[model samples]
Every structure is written in structure tokens, then in C-alpha cells.
Target chain A: MSLPPPAARPRRAPLALRVAAHEDLGGGLRWLTLAAPDVAAAAEPGQFAHVRCGGGLGPDGALGTRRAYSLADADPDRGTVSLLYRVWGRGSVWLSQRRPGEVLDVLAPLGTPFRLDPHRTPVFVAGGTGVAPFIFLARRARQKGLRPLAFVGARTAAELAGGEFLAAAGAEVAVATDDGTAGFAGTVVDLVVRALEETAAAGGLAGPSPALYACGPHAMMAALAAACAAHGWPLQVSLETPMACGIGICLSCTVPGPRGPGFYRRCCVEGPVFDAREVAWE
Target chain B: MSDLTTRLGPLTLRNPVLLASGTAGFGRELAEYLDLAGLGGIIVKGTSPSPWYGNPGPRTVETPSGLINSIGLENPGLRHFLEEDLPWLRTQGATVIVNVVGRTVEEYAAVAEGLAGADGVAALELNISCPNVKAGGIQFGHDPRLAAEVTRAVKAACGRPLFVKLSPNAPDVPAVAEAVLEAGADGLSLINTYLALAIDVARLRPVLPSVFGGLSGPAIKPLALRWVWEAHARFRVPIIGMGGIREWSDAAEFLLAGAQAVAVGTASFTEPRTAAFVVEGLRKWLDERGFATVGEVVGLAHRAIDGEEAVPLGQS
Candidate 1:
């Protein structure tokens, strides 16, 4: 995938953002509101920020820093960007210890965002923290006068994030939990398949069939991609891969492209967002 | 204040810390994390005569405290760099060293010739050792004659001080160093990433799309240090040592091994301000040890064994 010229999209540096608020969403998850006006102003649904942890003392404390998290919500006027993250490793553990009013190093407006065509009814599917970007997409759609439909899946009730926010925004949200502690008693992909089928049976996919957007585990996305392909809906996905630098320089985040298995694209630059069908999911 | 001024031949660095090329893309990618101008110097990503998309993806894999990559020297070509990136880089304050690569000797000379009189361009690093690309990369690095030829060719066309980046993958790193120095190389950068590979047992195939990648980080530090140590012992040319430098201690090891300066590569990935942090650490280490100028610390390990210096402090 050829990236946009550097002139078109100016790269942003990590902003020393103050933590406006912090909420503990248990099961090792966090909801952070960062005071990064620059990021809030430029952020889009799928693009993320690279957050560097361990802002302890001098430069040494900042070593082995940073992880990318999709923006869950952004308010340009309020100068805030929201993120929901699970404590997965040492980095997250360090991030978790951060208190309000503390400054964290954050690089924003990174990668391509999930595109929302106002005419197309947006169907967002997410698993776990994958629900992050949809908060922005949902709000953006509402601003454009579109009421979105969403499906969120988690292993259990504790793992689900942003369900309340989606509902508050007047979205038709369907929740699925593997343990049956939530809406649908099975996998999210199964719920998604049923939702599409029911919508189609009710009036032959009337008025712009839903455009599919998903972000989650690789397996979950692959399943969604196949489902979208079968139903003939345009699908976009945000991929999560290991990255050294969230910029184009490192070449660490690679994924196969539409060119076939042999050709690879830098995920950090080429995409964190890609057409679901274009990605060569092995 | 402990002086960090470093001299690599005619080129004088603000300090001895450098952002290794390819690691810091054109010096802008890491701008968000640290002040780019604060570091000693920046060896921007390798550029060729024209744009190169680089190798197929699956370009990197992590091992231990290191990273291996097959980025194939992907760059926007010399013209684009000179026209677009250079103006912004010059404003950043730190010295900028343009790293040039090519599929052929003429292309190398042409790139250098283009940057010959560019303002803010401090030096040029000849990356004849990139092992990711299918051709003209490690081939020139491993061959003494080819390495010297490329060095001589670029040095003639480029007016600025030229540093030949030596490949640890060479048949004899010292030989390559000596050849390049003889061919008018102003300095040297030792131990580009070693050519390496990895396999996914589950997939039962090579992990990287290129099948082989260059290994970097702490995993290759000792190995890179050996070459830097050897090359420094044999030549007067200042050597910039890099492989896996995560912290100040790693930078100290390279200095002790005889590198006049240390380039932070994979470490920058971990911390964009790693070089700056290293500069801070080096300063702290120096002042605490009763040393002043960082120049005073260069090759300190080579001078003494046990508790003495072959030449006492301030005597040399």
C-alpha cells in the first residue's frame, strides 16, 4: 500500500499530555482521558496514539517506552482523547500506576482511520478493547445524521467496554459474551451473521447495506472478513501488530497485502486500517 | 560542565551520541518523543538515487532485547530527501548525516554529489552493508575491494566528510575498515546488523517475508563491539559503534571497546529519546567518575587493565 505523501499528512510528535481523568474498568483495564488538544483536534476513528510509559525520572526512566492504543473518544473542543486499555504486559502495568494530573508522553493522530461514509449505515463490530475506535466512529456518524448499529463481544461481562456509551448515543447495539453473561449467548461473529441475515430478510438490505468496520483479535477480524465477503458488504478492519515505532521508519509491523502472500506492507504506515478483504489473512 | 564535544576527523559533533540511520527515519519520526536537535547527530535513513519500496514485508521480529529487520533501506530517494526533508531537518539544530545507499556505484556517487553542498548536512554515511535488499547491499559490504571502491567513489563526489559504515558480516571487518580509510574515508561506523533468520514452528516457514533479516540490539552488542574494538585498534579513523545499545551502560561498553561515538539503533525504537538519555547517562557517569570531557573517556578501557592506565589520565 502506497502511503500518502508526508506533505499531505504532517507527522505529529509525542505530546506531554496531562491525565485529565482516570477510571478503573476492572479485569485489568483502564479508561484514560488525556489532555492532548492537538491529538483531539486531529484524531479520527481508527487512528491511534503511541503512549510512552515510565516517565519516572530522567531519560533513562523513559527507556523501552510506548504502546499504541486506538482512540476511544476524542473531544477537540474539550481538548481530550479517551482510551480503554487492558493491562497486558509490563508497559500497561506501568501505565496503570499513573495518577490524574500526571503527564504521560503521547504521540497522536497516527495511521489511517476507519472511514465512515455518511450514506452507508455503519455496522461496527468489536471485541474487548477493540471497542475503542467505535466510540469515535459512532459519534462521528451521529454528527453526520446516521444512527449506527454495533456488536460488541467479550469473554465475560467484565471484559466488555463502552457498551453503555454506544447505547447512550442511540445506537442499536448487540452484545455477545462467550460465557453467556451478556446479550447474545454465543460468539460475536455468530451474532453478526444473524444480525445481517435478519436485516436482509426484513426488507432485502434496504437503503445502503451496512458498511462493516471491525477491530479486535486477528481471529475475530478474519471471521468478520469472511462474513462480510459472503454478505457482500464493504468491510474495513484495524489490525493490531507488534510495532517498534508507530511510524513508517521501523518496518517492524508487517502484514501480507492484497498482492498475495509474498508481498508485505508495513502495517504502521500502510495501515492500522485496511480493507478487510485486501488483507491476506493467513 | 562535563564536555560532550566529539571529533570524528574534520567533523565535530555536539556530543558523541548519534541516532542510527534506518532507526530514526529522516529524523522526523522520533521528533514527537524527543528533541531531535538535542542529540549529537542524526544519520537519517539510508537513501538511494530514486525511491525504493524496499523488501517485501514481515520485515521484523523481536528476539531478547533486540530487533531484526529486513526493511531493505526503504527511502524516498535523494532528490525527495534534498527537496523535501532537508529543509525541515536543518531547522532541528542537531548535525545531520545523510546515509546513502545504491544498487550500483554510479547511483551512490550521484546521491552524494546531490547532497554535496546542501546546507545543514554535516556528513554522509555510506551504508554499503544493508543485508536486506536482494542485491548490491551485503555484497559490497563483504568484499574489501567493492567496499573501498564505493568509499572512494562517494568520497570523490561528496565534499563533506564521509564515513564508511562497516559491515560485521564482512569477511574481515578490519580489512574493510583499512581499505575504506585508505580510500579516503574520514571515519567509520562499525557493525551494521548481522544477517540472520528465524522460523515459525507453527507456520513451519521463515518468519520474515525476505526469509533473512539483519539482527540488532543487545543480542549483537558483544559481537559488534569486537569489530569496533578491532577496527579502532588498527586505524586512526574514528569509529561509530552500534548494534544493540539500550541504555548508558551499553554506550559505555562501545566507548570502552574503542568507539569514539555510539549510535543508538533498536534502543530508539524502545525510547525515541534513547540517544538523549544515553547522553544524560554518559554525562552522569563521567562527572561521578571525576572525568570532565567525554573525549577523555574514549577508549578508557583500552588504556588500562586492573586499576591503572597505560597512559595516566591527562598525560595523553
Candidate 2:
């Protein structure tokens, strides 16, 4: 059993892309569409764009350190790429304030994106804004004549972003909310485990083995990792870290590797998406 | 067009803007964004005798106008560099300055010895100033005698022009600069990141696993400038001033404060083409000021002062 080869690292340059559309999306979520022909053409699902927020080449330009956001959608025909982000900090706040037609400095199609194996059934688990990349993933999976099963979780129905987007992208969407305002009134991981058990009992997983793909709060991903390990499922997880350079140079975004206790891998180059077995979960 | 060509001791560069060590990652990543041969030089990430895992995450935090990193000088060992990175960098036509790190003086000397006759290695920078590591980094930088000892060891091991990087955490930076220069160091890369810390309020603990990290960015520019000014005023060696140089103005300040060359550090994280932009901007700045070459601007600020005393503007 040889491991699958890693995704090829994208060659990127900073582009001053024009914002085509911006939406509030209520409940703290903001969706942005940028006219980026090259990025839209080359970006794979789970790859991200490092965007410079707020300050624009001025004396306070130092305040504009690039923040990484997953590329949520790409329309090659439209020559556009979209990002879904929560206004979490100063950087995002700056990003949220941008209007349509405004220019953004972006370094795109970065990091190792998620690779879908056609031999395995694609199952995606997302928590909160972690649903961003899955939209792109679901769309790509659909294009390949695959029906992706997506489990999306949030604190409430109002915060549940991308569930509708996932459905529109041809994925079978399952929603879980902590406040019981959504489909499954429990944790998404628990929902996934229950679904897996029921599917196993019904022999619904007979044709192809289900592979778990996730991006979420650390605790949720950890729980999902445990569940996948129990079911002997191969899992791929998209991780989030405080990143300075979205490129591999700074080595700021590192996750502990499965090699041993001290060994680590660069998140930017190695992956934002990795085999759950490759990560040393604490 | 004004000449951007400048010399840092034994190394002659096309310009005075080099990518700081650790920020540019051996010229591969940044090469995708900018032309490698276009900049002054590239000082790659610190290379150790053996591979270092560095500190565990969360390794970086963004404060006001600054970033704190506890990467602990993590690098692929010397063998990997000589095998994989060096040849690629050479093909890019980059002026490669290898920033060498080690756990002991012997290890530093060994890396220097390995790169002694390596192709395309323009110089060697001894990284005794990295604050994140426990064993060898700042431990050598803080003490003048140890700083000189490592400098002498590497100087003896390699025939390349040696520049000893000084730590801002060092109690007396000039003292260490003096010691290294006396020990046969050709130049100095002044003011690596400052030792700093950030706490997580929600978790009620330190943000970085290392507890402390080195702070860099615009926050430390003034501190770095003052040190460069002092070092240049006292010593007659070429200095590569860094720590928070983001743009042409910041690069100009370093040169005015007596740095023959400037390295763009944290700025590169935001914009990969910052060093190239600085190079272009500096040339235009010199042309606008009627200066023919970058050397004319080096230490120009210090020349305005009269014999160690402050001379006010228009009184010189």
C-alpha cells in the first residue's frame, strides 16, 4: 500500500484582482467574488488565496499582512474566484469593508489542495465556515460524475453557511446544528458516525469504501479522525493555522507530522489538506 | 538611471536589497513571484548540521504591526541544501548567502566547511541571533566572547565572506559586533528579531508553544535603525540592516543609517515582490535626489552630525 502522491504546489504571483461582487450573507459570513482569470483557471479545491487587507501601499502598509482564505468557488468562464470568510479579526474586517470594483492584492492558488480519489466514495464533513472549500470540492466531484455526501455543522441554522451551496453543487447535504435549529440536532461528527453505522448495516457502502474529508474546529476534526479510525476509513483533513506567509517560506504554518513527537510538516507546501493518519493528533 | 550597484564587504551586489534569512526560503518560493536574479541577493533560511524540527505550533501570532514567530530556526540539514536547494538557486542566477546555524561552534564550522567551495554561494551568514532556539541560537549571540568564538571558527572553516548576524536581545550589540569583526568577520547583518511573547486571553496561556517568539515587522524598525546607526558610526565594516524593512523608505533609512545593504524581512510575508519593489524604488529615489549611486546614500544621515554630537538640520 503506497500512499497517494501529494498535490502539486501551485506556482503563484501576487495579483491585484478586482472585486466583482461582495455580499454580507448575514450572520457574520461574507462572500466575495474577484475577477481572477488565472487563479480561477488553475486553482484546485482546498487551495487558498493570501489577501492583503486594509492598508494599501501607504505608510501604514505594514498593517496589511496577508491573510489566507480558502478559494470557495471558481468560474473559469466568468474568470472569477470567490472567497467565504467570517469577519474574525482586523484583516477580515478590512476585507469585509471592500466594495465591488475595488482592487485587492491577492496571492492565489496556494498550498496543496484536496485530491479526490475516484476509487473511494467522497464524504465531506464541514463545521461553520469550514464549508468554504467543500463547495468547490463538491462542484468538482459532480463534474467527475461523482455524488459527494456533505455533512455541514454550525452553532445554529443562521450560522450554517454553504449547506445550500453544497446542495446546489450536486452534493447530498446533511446539516447539523448545536442549537437544534437545523436537520440533525447534534454534533456533525456524531451524525457522520451514526450515518456510517446505518450505511454499513444497510450494506450501502458495498461498492466503494467511503473516505472522510473534513475541515472544522480542531475538536470536531479530532473526533472525526477518531470515528474514521474506528471504521478503518481513510481521512483527509483541511487544517487552519495562524499563517504569516501562505507560501512555504516563513514556515509559520506547521502541523505536527505523524513521523514522531517532534517532527513537523509545512502546512503551506505539504498541505492544508492531509491524510488524517499523517497528522499527529494531540 | 542612478546606479543601484553596491558592495557589502567582499560581495558585490547589483543592488542593495536582499531577502532576509528565513523569510524567502532558499529562493524557490519567492522565485515564483519575482525574478531571483533581479534582486541584490537572497539569504536563505538558517541551515543546521542536522535537520531541526523547530518548536511546535502555534508558532506565529500577529500583534500590532508585527509578527511573532518561534520557528526555532527549523531547517533541512546542510546535506539537503547542498543536494537540493543550492543547485536550483544557482540556476536562478541569485546571489546566494547561506545563513548557517548550529548547536555548537563545531557544527557551525562544519556547515561553513561544507559550503567552502560550493558553487554560487556568494557569502555565509552566521546566525547566532535566532531567539527561538534553546541550545545554540541566542545563547552565542548574548555573549561577546562566544560570538567571536563561533565567528572565528566559521571564518577559519570557510573561505567565503562571513557576516555575523547580531541579536537585538544581546545586552550590547556593538560589543558583539566589535568582537566578531575583530575575529575576522568581513561584515555584519545587524538586528535579528527581538525576543517577545504574546498570550492567548481565551485560553489564558501563551500563544506560541515556545512561550516566547521573535518579533519582527514595522514595530522594530526604529530599534533596528538606531543599532545600525550606532554600529556604523563606530565600526568601518559593511552592514546588512534588516528587521522591519518593508519598502523603499525603510530601505533608504537603513542605508542612511549606514547599512550598505538592506534585507526585507516581515514585509516579504505580505508582498513577495517587496524586495524587488524596494530595489526599483530605491533607484528612483536616488535618481530623484540627483545621487549617482547607492553608496552616496550610505551613512549620509551620520555625516550630518559633527564629531559624536547631534547637529540640528541646517546647522551642519
Candidate 3:
């Protein structure tokens, strides 16, 4: 089977963009829209923005590091790019407190983006805030005249953030909660596997096989990868490794490479997204 | 305008702001965001005789105003660097200082010897202070004898000017400095990340997989500055001071502490344009102070304490 070639790496720079809007999506999730025309125009699905969070541009800044966040959506004509993040750390708290019109320093359209194959059906799996990139992915798939399927998981219904947005983007979203306070009583991986098995049993799984796209906690993605491997499906995973530079310079963000044990690839430059098989999941 | 030109012994830099090794990778990565030809120079990531895969997952953890990283000196090896990265760096008009690492003294000499034939390489910075790697990194750096042995071997193998990167974890940094300098190193690169660790309270485990990573960023600035000052006071060789240099003021402090040139390391991770920004800000700072050149500021803090007219040893 021919794999999709790597996404074209777009040129990026640190842009000082104004916060166009901010929405507290409840459950600590925040939706921030920035007026970044260049970034919106250049961003592709699975790409991220490195945002300088808190304090002034100095060594003594509250958080002297830049935090990486996936682009939730981008509108080139509107000159806006949106980020969906959970206010978990000091950086995210500072980002959440940012008022409209406050300028933010961001390095956008970084890392290799997801390679969407036109011939295959798109199936997205996300856990918690991992749903951030899938909204953009679903929108892109819809634009390409493909029906995207998404499985979103969280601890509870209130914790779920992106399923509604995914649905609005024309994706069929299935949700699973750990407490069974949402869609499926079991894990998202179990839900997807059951759905796929039932479809095959009913002979409704004909035509080109569906390709799985995933982003979530490590355990969730690893389980999904195993299921996809068993079903002979293609899977691509977006990793959320701790990164210092969203660019390739700092080799701080690394994942085990497919080469062998001890071999690793830079998650920043090589990919925030990689073919599931290319990663040596623990 | 104040002259930003900085001379480190035999090497002359257009400016004193250089992107530190490991942080800059090859010039190819930062070249996308900033103009390579504009800065003083680019110290490429530590390259070995052969490719090293480095440490496992979770290589970095963020601390208060700092970052701990166990990158283990991962590089594409000497062959790939000379064949692929060097040509592009040369074309960009970047003064390339290749940081060499090895698992053995022979390996260090081999990589240095290999780069000796490369066209664009301006100098070699021996990285004997990488704390993340187990085999040959800080192992050579902590002991003055081992540090001098590797420095002597590389110096014999290559014709290029050698700068030995010092480790803060060393029991006596000045001892290592004296050993490498006595072994024929042209200059010194002070403070290659402090050996440190961070525990994840939630998981009750170390943040980095390697357990102990090198701590960088503003948290270690004072420690790095102290080492630079001590080394400068004891030795006459040029010192490339680095460790949490985030802006022009930080760079200025390093110059005052007696660093001939300053490298921006972790700050580049926060802002890729930091090195270039420092170049401009430092020039403006000097001009405002009525200093004619960057050399005028080098080691000025020492003179203030000594209460005597002191010559900048770096110029010698």
C-alpha cells in the first residue's frame, strides 16, 4: 500500500498577534482566537503553535518557556487561528487570562502535519484535550468531500470539549467517558474496536479500509494502535511530547523511533504526527 | 554605533552573540526563523564519529525559569554533517563551530580529524561536559586529567582552533580549565548545563527518563556567571560564557564577568530570534554607554572589584 508522503513543512516565524476572542469552554478548556493571518493561511492539520506564556520577555518571566498547543481551527480569510487548551499549568493559566486585544507571542505552523489520504475513510480518536487537532482535521476532511468519524473520550460528560465542534465540522463523533457519564460505558479504544467489528460482521466494511488518526494519552493511543494493527488498518498518531522549541533546534521532544530499541526521532521536526508503525510505542 | 566585533584569540567574530551548540542544532533549523549570516556564528549540535540515538522518551522537563534536558548529545554523525549540513551552512555565510562529542578519546580525535578536511568549519568546541550521556560525556569533564587527555588528542588530530567546553558539575572547574588549556586548547566554553534532576510528584518518579538531565535557563545563570568569573580570574584564555542568557542584559553580564563571547542556549528555545535580538540590544547598550566596542566591556566587572586598571586578557 502506498503511504501518503510527508506534509510540506511551512516556513514560520514568531508573530506578535492580538487575541481576537477568548471563550471559557467550561471544564477548564479555553478557546482562544488570535488575529494571525499568516499563520491561518499556512497552518495544516496536526500542526502546532509555540506560545510564550506569562510575564514579559525576560529571563525572570513567570514561565520563561514556550508552551506548545495544537491549532484547533484556522480561517485564512478571517485572519484568525484558534487554539483549544485546558488551563492546567501556569502557562495555560496565563494564556487563559489573556484578554482580547492583548498581544501574544507565537511561533505557528510548526512540526510536520498529518498526511490525509483522499482514498481512505478518516477515523479520528481523541482523549481529553487531545481533541484539539481533530476539529481542524475533520474540517479539512469535510472540505475534501469525506465523511470523518471521530471518537472523543474524557473522564465525564462535562470534561468532553471537542465532540460538538467535531460534529459541527461535519464529523460523526462517538464519545466515551471513564465514569460512563457520556456515550460509551467502556474505553474509547473498546468502542472503536466494537464498532469496527460490528460493521465488518454486517458486511458494511467494504471498499477502501478506514485509516485511523489518533491523539490522546499514551495508553489510549497505544491500545488503539494495537487494535488497528490487528485489523490491518493504517494509523497515524499525533504525539504530545514535552517540547521546548516547537522547531527542530532543541531535540528535547523525542519519541522512540521505528529503527530499533534506543533509536529516537525528534517529535518537533519529524512529527507531532507520525504513522503509528513508525513509532515504537511503549 | 559601537563596534560589535569580538575576537577570541585567533578567531574573529562579527559579533559576540553566537547560538550555543545543542540549542542551535545545525544552522538549517534556525535558518528558517532568523538570518544565519547576521549572527556572530553558529555552534552546530554535538557531532560524534558515528550517529547516536540518544536517550529515551520524556527527554525534557520544565522547571521554574529553567529546563532540564537529557538529549544525550544526539547527532547525525560526522559523515552526514560534512556531507549534508556543512555545505548549506557554508553557503549561508555562517561562521560554523562544530561541537564534537565522542564515547572515547579515539572517537573524539576521529570526528575532529574528519572535520579538519571540511571547508567551512571555523573551529571545534570539544564537548566533554554533556551530563546526559553515560559513556564519554561528563566522564571526561569531571576529571582534569581525562579532560586534558581528550583535549590533547583532538588538538593533535585537527589543525583548527580548539575550545574546550567546561562542566559545572566538575569538582574544580578551574582545574579542568587549566588542564585543557595546558593541553593546548585555544580557549574555553564555560558552563555546559548543571547536572540536575526533577521529580514528578504525581508519578513519584524522575521527570526525565535518564533520571538526571542537564539543567539550563535562567535558574543557572548566576552559577554559570560565577564559573565564568572564576575561570577568567585564573586563566587568560578566551571564555564563551553561556547558561540562561535570555537577553542583551544577560549577555552584557557575561561580558562583564569576562566572557569574550556569549552563546545563547536555552533562550533560543523560548525565542529563536534571541541571539540576533541580543546582538542589536548589546550594540545599542554599548553605544548608549559611550563604549566604542564590545571589548571595552569584557571583564570590566573584574576591574571594578580589583580597583585597578586591568587589561582584558582575552585581547592577549
Candidate 4:
């Protein structure tokens, strides 16, 4: 059977954008805050922004590629979104060099924001630079006055830029490192298990089971999912897939989801966020 | 007052500029960023039987002036595209040239037969040049007989204008182009992405799960131009040249090299309306020079090279 026709997905609305702030968060990571006049004033916690870099041309007026990043901070009231990215590719390098007065072409409110039930405690786990989304999620969770546990994993102490923010949110914060360069010598999954066990041991789980939300390396998420299964915990995971069109047409950023066998879903349109159990972890 | 149009057998394009298949996604996503109406035509992503899961993860990596992608011919089966994607594209208000792909000669025929009556699909481009997929891809592209066979099959199955998108990996691109043209292809789309790969240092593994991937971008432009120019020198088939066209000068180069049209793939990722910009640039240059038409520039660059001459119009 010839494949079915493509779904005519909704076009992303154009955004009126301006760079609000630019800061180097140290360790090759820089954060940019952008204001979009057109987006819904209320930006959700788990959503991401599609960033367009200017002067993609290499000193010759050549074209540049576009990239998507999770919004680490969003104030719908202020019509601004914060983007945190690590210097890895040319896109990131160009982004890091961007100055404060510069303007960028961007589309926002992409991907479903992380979904969490207020009644269920949100347990956030992050690995390396994947911690960006969770930091925003932590803030939103706290703003709702729901204190969730956050386990942030980094290779070394210098990499955990959001540790203080997570701690100040009134959420129990645990740090882990594989090389023992900073906190416990292990992955974030280990730290999450330890924290959850302590909470359960203190008889804190008599109510609704804590919901797990994790974002990081595929290996790290797979491990966290296993830990969730072991503890009978329900989890939501945010994924980072290669995507050129945030609108889902390119079919470049697809991950196996709960849909069907070998059936894939777009990380940009369907979600950059999904229930952990729904994701088919390999 | 300008002759911006060109003919590829029975098909007539307003100008000699086309969007490459697999690079431009049906013209819907990029419509917002650029003017789709300005292009000669648009090529949708590769289509196949049933939905293809494509490659695992790490499908793209940046290498100098190019990008390597092992996206494994990912697309919803043709049925979904005819039903869901085509109608929406009609609403996007642009003429769409559908790019079709299949795993077998029979599969290609079936797709052509299926799209025969579809409304809004202005033309059909047969994509036999994809490099990453294990089946079908590069197979039909690498050999003249197979490429001609597929082209002939698809041409028999569909009445719409047919374009055979040629692969750059083949030894003699002109031979492959000629085979398909004789087999009934309406025109030729030259030089899809080159087969390439990248490595992940930390994981000590190939960056893409597929191990090998197709390289596209500015890096492959020169190579693509050479193939297009070679085919143009050898055949009269209207060639849609594309590789790493980012601006007007690049498009002009392709036009001068004998391409009736050109496609902008990787540049769209960087600037969505780049194809339109190229088209406009072509118009501006032609108007300033008072050439009165685009054809005057086509194949003009080859004239300067003393040794190279247009092959006799009917060389078999």
C-alpha cells in the first residue's frame, strides 16, 4: 500500500521578536531571553521556542540553519521567553556570539508544555544540559505552590547552573555526577531513587504516587524509566530530537511514542514532552 | 516583456527554478517564511508505501559547508499525503510538484497510478536517488537500466509530467540521465545528496545510527553543479539543478550551466524563502542586463570553455 497523504498540520503563527537579555551562564552555555509580542501571554512550563540565527553565512553572506531549544524561563505577562543552550554546533556558536541589542527570528509556544497534575507531586530529573526545561518546570511547579523534587545530573560542579534555582524553589534538590566531579558518583537516576526512597521511608507516599518528569540523554531517560517501573511510578519525559521544521512537516524529529508498533511521533508538533510510559524506550 | 519560462516536453514552468524533493516538505511549512508562489514548482518530501519509521536517532550532523542526514526516506504512505497533505497545500496557495519514491518497480508504478487522478498535485517527480534507506534507494539511481525501468514504469502509470531526480553517486550521471529521458521522463532533476558519514567522538560510535548518510549543503554544490553541467552538455532534457544554492548568484550559475531550473534545499532550512529570493534575483539580473529572457543565459557559461560543447541535440 502506498503511504497515506501527509497531514495538513496547522501553520505556526509568526512572532514579533526581540532579544530581551543575553548572558553567558559559564561553562560554554549562554542564555538568551526573547520577547514575542504575538504569543499567548501565558507561556506554559514545558514548551520550547524555535530560534533562527542571523548571518548563517560564513563571512560570505551565506545561509545559516535553524535550531529549536526548550524555553528555560517564560513570563507570559512580560511577553518574554528565556532560551538556554550549550555551545556544541555552528548554530549554537552563532547563538552564543549574539549580542544583547540584536534581533532574532523565532517561533514560540511550540511542543506541548509539560503536563502535570497539581494533586500529584512532580519529581523532575535532568541529565547534563537537559536540565533547562526542568528548571522552568520547577519554577512553574513552585509558583503553583506545589513543591516537587528535582534531581539534576551534571558531569562536574561547574555544569549545574540551575542548582541554586532548583533549591530556592523549595524543592528537594539532589546532584549526581558520573566521575564524582561534584555530587554523588552516579547518574541522576540513582539520586532520584535515593530521594524517592527517603520520602517513602518517611511515610510520605500514602497519598497519590509521585509523578516523574525527566529530560536528558536517551540512555539516562531509559534508566530513569526503568527506575520508574521498579517503583510503580508514572512519569512524563521531555525528548530532544533532531528537527528542522517545528511544525512537524519535515518528519526529521520523530521518536517512537505510545501510538503503535514502529509508529513514530513528532517531537516538535506532537510533543517535545510526553508521558514516560507512553514513550517506547529502547 | 521577459521570457522567464521554459519547456520540459509538455510541461511549462514560469521560470527555471524548482525546489528539490526531500529537502522541501510539500511547500506548506516553508510558506510562512518565503513566498512559495514565486518558484517554478515545489517538490514534496519522498513518499512511499505505508508509513516508513525511518532511521533511529542522531539523523543529522554538520560537516563544514554541508549536513549529513540518514533520515531513511521517512514519510507517511502515499495515501495519507494525497488525502491529508495535498488539500492543505492547495490552501497554502501554491502549485506543488509531488516527489514520489518506491521500493520496487511495481511500487513506483503503484504510486504513479495512485496519484494519477489526485487534484492539486501539479506534477510528479520520481525520487530514485535517496542514499540512506536499505531498500529501493540508490539502487534504481546507480544503474542506467534500473533507473530507466523505474522511469518508464512510472511514466506509463501516470499522465502527469514526470521528472527523474538523478543521483550524484552514480559513475556516469549523463548516462543515467539519458537512460531515463529515453525511458519517458519528461525532464531531469540533477544531483541529490551525496553519500557521506560523520562520527561521534565521545560515544566512539558513528554519529548516525544508519552509519552512512546523505550529505547536503554548500559542500556538495560544486559537485552537483558539475553533474548538472555535464548532463546539460550531453542532453537537451530540461535539467532542474540543485545542490547548495543559497543565493541569486548560485541560481544564476546553475542557469548558466544549462539547467532550465534550479532547486534550493539546505538553504531553505536557513532561510525559508531563499528559493523566492533566488528567483527574484534572477529576474533582477535579467532585467538590468536587458536580456529580455532567461533562456539567453542558459548554457552560456559552457560557451566560454573552448573544449566543451553541447552534445549534438539527439545523441543516443
Indicate which candidate wins on TM-score: 3
Write candidate 4's Cα lDDT for A1-282 as tens digits. 432223343334446577788888788888788866455365677788877764454435333456888888776677777877898876788778877767877777778888877888888898877778877888788888777878889877777757765676566788898788888888788888987888789987655569889888999999989889888988888898877757655566788866554477778877888877778897
lDDT of 3 by residue, A23-98 (tens): 9888899999999998999999999998988853344565767889999999889999999999988789888899
Q: List the global CA lDDT of all models.
A: 0.82, 0.88, 0.88, 0.78
Tens-digit lDDT string for candidate 1 (B242-305): 9888788989888877877889998777556678789899888776776777777777776675
For each candidate in turn, the TM-score is 0.78, 0.94, 0.94, 0.87
DockQ of 1: 0.27
Off by over 4 Å in 4: A1-20, A35-42, A52-64, A77-79, A88-94, A104-109, A168-172, A177-186, A205-208, A243-249, A258-262, B1-4, B303-316
Cα deviation at B212, candidate 3, in Å, is: 1.5
Error of 1 at A264 (Å): 7.8
To one decimal, what is the Cα RMSD in angstroms of model 3 from the true structure?
Answer: 4.5
lDDT tens per residue, model 2, B79-174: 889999998787777899999999999999999999997888999999999998889989999999999999999999998999999998999888
**Interface DockQ per candidate:** 0.27, 0.42, 0.47, 0.27
Q: How well is each residue in B237-257 modelled by candidate 3, as lDDT tens digits?
A: 798999999889999999999
| Shift in Å, residue A166, candidate 2 | 1.1
Per-residue lDDT tens digits for candidate 4, residues B106-129, read: 998888888998887778889889
Tell me which residue pairs clash in candidate 3.
none
Model 4 CA lDDT for position B300: 76
Pick by DockQ: 2 or 4, better one: 2
